[model samples]
Target: MIDTKELIDSGDLELYVCGALPANRAQEIAQISKQHPEVLEEIISIENAYQRLAAGLAPDHNDETYAKLEAIIGAKNKVVKSPSSWSPYIGWAAAGLLLIASGYFYNANNETNEEIVQIEQQKEFLETENIEIESINSQYASTLQVLSDPETVKVNLAGQAGFESSNAVAFYNNEKNVTYIDIQGLPEVPENMVYQLWSLTLDPLTPTSLGTLPIEKESYNELLRIDNAYDTQAFGITLEEAGGADAPTLERLYTLGVIDKG
Candidate 1:
């Protein structure tokens, strides 16, 4: 029930990538990413970005530099007896002050770099979200146009004998040779079975298959578009095996509707 898009937009994924998220929260994200491919893809993209950033900013150093750095650190750690002169003491104090200032500026610079990375991530997310929104809006507009067309015929499919509660609606446009079915009221399909549509010819009692409905539960309420150029007198939906049947299974019929020629 978690909204993946909202989670991605919440900036938690970026924190997760940076290892800044709490252990429990990080594990939750990991589990969700397994269930949702888009989330996983985003996580990978963020990691790649960080890798590229690190590669670009990392200082070039070899074993010799590391050895030199270790020696310097060892030298600093050696006990130094207090000198009689005040001049040396003043010089040591000045060096300590300079070190503190350098540490402060280095921390500030790191904070600024982190902020830049976050801003870039936000910009990318926004652009992606905007494109998805535009694509969805365009689809809605097209669906509205098809439903509003005067040539489109609306057919209501009532529940069959055993399926008293199942219902669905279909918008068929003969001129456009397209059909969209709204099956929001249909019951959840059983496992290993699929809902198949049939375009019927009453005169000869013939049924032409119009393909199968998607098995996704999330898509049940959405309008399912099917190509139907057949001269159909009635429409029927039936539960069939996974790959669907060569013809409608009368016993498994869930909903039925007849078109009015008059």
Candidate 2:
């Protein structure tokens, strides 16, 4: 779409509205006029100018013609006055009905304008929201590019212990390190329950619980984001009882994966 402000500033729009342009340009102007009310208003002003010029060029009528018109109008007024005197009640009734209809039409027009304004406001709000969503999507794309770099270490976590079949993958970066968990394979956590991740160091079998995954049952992209991952060893997933787990439950170990040394 062309910029409206630029189109308006171009003198071609004025020439098009004046009907001085070629057929193609005229068609373009007509399409623009249909799309933009301001363009249509400009066209109307140009048409009114043409009308006034044509009227000014017309032949003039003399004072005798004006006198004849006045005489005819005066005669008609007297004839109308006689009937009007006899039908004062009818005239009053018609006037009352006209007032009621005018009021009704005025109110309807006001309501229609209000509805149009509300719709325009809603459209503007939706457009702004779409822009914000697009911006967030772009940022996520950049984050994915960084996470999927060839140097980033990949880990496949497989379900263990109680939940034996569920699986997930985590991509971790050491330099500019971060962890992203693609948990689509994991089943939905029950109400008030969450999946807790653990970062493990193998020598003494100690683990750092890296917080819970917020369940998004309806999201199209079900991957969860975990940040600040300058990890010492392995990755593990456990079913935490509500909110999050303060410590990993070895009995509820849903998945585990050793980080690739390479």
lDDT of 1 by residue, 32-136 (tens): 786679999999999999999999998886767765776778733322233233333445778775776576566666666766776777799999999999998
Q: Which number leads on TM-score?
A: 1
What value of lDDT does candidate 2 attain over all alpha carbons?
A: 0.74
Clashes of 2: 0
Error of 2 at 65 (Å): 60
Candidate number with greatest lDDT:
1
TM-score of every model versus the real structure? 0.62, 0.54
Model 2: what TM-score?
0.54
Candidate 1 RMSD to the correct structure:
16.5
C-alpha lDDT values of all predictions: 0.84, 0.74
